[model samples]
Target: MDDKELIHQILQSNNGIIEARQASEAGINNKTLQRLHQSGDLERIEHGIYIDPNYIEDIYYITQLRCKQGIFSHETALYFHELTNRTPFQLQLTIPSGYNTRLIKDKERFRFFYIKKDLFEIGKINMVSPFGNPIRIYDKERTICDVLKKKDQLDADLVSSAIKQYIKEPGNDFSKLLTYAELFKIKDIVRQYLEVII
Candidate 1:
């Protein structure tokens, strides 16, 4: 009925997380948020993000909130899509070329890839983070294409495993995989791997 109740409702609906922008949009001002934070009712996790003290932080979702343009990709996407069993050591995020990644704090926690703006959104999809928060990531086909494109820089076994698992996935779309491979200029390489695996 009031600002505090509205804030609690927002937090409850958003997995106990709330962004200042979201609160503002709900007609609760910054002053109210600050008051709540001062009273220990909310914890400030990032610059403009807050959460209930009892809530476990979803690093993936929090990172996405901090870097709105970032989409989990490469090995991170593979792990999320169940194409790989290995968990990534660092979060892999892709953003449009020329985006200022320097603005992202804790740079060491992530491995960022830059892509042409035109191709940035290709195969982007919503996936639930391990913490059950919604996060943006690349679909399986796009992730396979991306990993193949960077095969030289990634672990050979990891790449091989991901490709093998992807090929065996019942939901995989080979047409989309090849289409994305063509766009990444790795069509021939993709076919070579597919031929070997399939």
Candidate 2:
């Protein structure tokens, strides 16, 4: 296919977002991206991330794409689970230990947690961000365990409030929370919080 057609097909499949590598795979090159930008067909959002000029961006999806192994965690996970009302200024991502994040040039925008590879995928689930981009995040149960594990770094009031909110939220499963607590080794802390709230 020609450059324009290849770009069009990619844009259509990816909700209007395109990456440089994707273009390369389709036989389009860096010069073509620059040409498309100059011609007003595409807008570059980051170093290698681009989108159709008309597309409304899902910024977190772009972030997730940048950190391929990142799973939304901590405050960001709380927001996804609706256990907290405050939006996190910096997104939190958890990646497995030994994964190099140096390749992500814009790493300051995220706070990362490194878990052992064996534990990295625990309670990982896919959910749409507020902007409607699908992302990997910890389930509510695992989020609770995470926050409890890192409570020292979080505001006491915020931690208390999030646990209270989760306790009241319909469809929350205490059994799942308990299970994750075992994996996270924060069962006593989680139990204490739940006992106080429930």
Candidate 3:
């Protein structure tokens, strides 16, 4: 297929979104992307990210694309897993301790939690964003452990509610939850909460 046809197919398959890197990997050069943008066939959403003009922007997907190392975590992850009903006022992201936060534009849009590199990938999982784009986030087990670790900075009601909601889910894994708590050195705290709830 021709480059334009390939681009059209990519956009169709990706829910009207495309990335410059993806186009480049598909053998379409930056000049072609620029030409498409100039012709109003594509809209630049962020550096290296583009979308069809009529498409609604997927903020979560775009954020991950811009900050590849950031993983949705804590309350944000809780929301994604339906462990809590409250929407986070500012999206929460977890990044490795040494990651360069300054490189992220609009830093105020996110609340970042930094962890050691070794622990960064623990319980990482992909979930579809509200816009139907796959985004990296912490699994429920890890998210609970993380919030428990940072309970002092969060609302007690929110924490309790999350634990309660998680307990109500049929697929909830106490073993995995405890294991993550142990890894995070919050096993006793997690157990105490579980004891009260269960």
Predicted structure with the largest lDDT when compared to the true one? 1
TM-score of each: 0.93, 0.87, 0.90
lDDT per residue, candidate 2, 78-119, as tens digits?
Answer: 888878888888788888988976534555567888899998
lDDT tens digits by residue: candidate 3, 1-198:
889999999998998888988898999888888899989999987778888988888778878887889999988898898888887777889999989754355655788899999999999998999889999999999999999999898788988898898988897889998989888999999999989888
Cα-based lDDT for every prediction = 0.89, 0.85, 0.88
Ranking by lDDT: 1, 3, 2
lDDT of 1: 0.89
Model 3 stretches with alpha carbons more than 4 Å out: 101-107
Q: For model 1, state the Cα shift of residue 85 in Å.
A: 1.9
List, residue by residue over 77-189, the lDDT tens digit for candidate 1. 98998878887888989999988755355666888899999999999999888888889999999999999889888788898998998888797799998899889999999
Best by TM-score: 1
The residue pairs in collision within model 2 are none
